[model samples]
Target: MMSSFMRKSLGQFLATLMVIAALAVTSMPARADALDDARAAGLVGERADGYVALVDSNAPANVKNLVKDINDKRRVAYQKIAAEKGVPVEQIGAITAEKIIREILQPGMYYMDATGAWKTK
Candidate 1:
């Protein structure tokens, strides 16, 4: 039989593990689904120039906020890359956007044109 102290420690460890597993299962899908749903619904689209754009002016508040959050994160990433490479932030953004559009965009998703129009691919 295990000592009382060992049993208590084991229970605590198991509880912590359960919490971590629960979080991992629940948190990841919501973020991915938010973006996927927003794109599918035409609320947001990838731009040819290498940024996200609001496709629908009347999109829901959550979708609009999501776009802003993603764009903000992208800006930070672009800044980091630009500093590392000694290039302009806009240049980094443009290059990254091109690569995302070309390699990461999936079929039947929405994307923006150079003329500021949304198109489905």
Candidate 2:
């Protein structure tokens, strides 16, 4: 179990990481036919689990593949962080999702809230 000091340190660490992640997402250069494009075009949406999902069930193969690839990477990252911090991977992911939704999501972008419904940012 984490001590009080360790929990405080972890909280600070997560806050800093969230800011960095938000800045990274916001500062990225947009590329054609990429994640940004997919998001802007309403082809995809962010989930409360810190992963991207297709807004439409009939989205193209490319969108599916992109979501799969990105989510896979995120899962790996979350797992690493969770193991290091002795926390559940889902907790890390949910925290990350909160940051992304509040700081990184742009107007017209879609995200799933706690009710499992997609809403525009």
Clashes of 2: 0
lDDT score for residue 49 of model 1: 51
Report the error of model 2 at residue 21, Å.
Answer: 5.5
TM-scores across all candidates?
A: 0.69, 0.79
Tens digits of per-residue lDDT, candidate 1, 24-51, equal 3433577658877888777788886556
Superposed by TM-score, candidate 2 places the C-alpha of residue 58 at a distance from the truth, in angstroms, of 1.7
> For each candidate, how many residue pairs have backbone atoms clashing (under 3 Å)?
0, 0
1-121: candidate 2 lDDT, tens digit per residue: 9999998777757754953464355433543248788889899989998888999888899888888877776777777767766777787788778877888788999999899999999
Alpha carbon deviation, residue 106, candidate 1 (Å):
2.0
What is the Cα-based lDDT of residue 41 in candidate 1? 77
TM-score of 1: 0.69
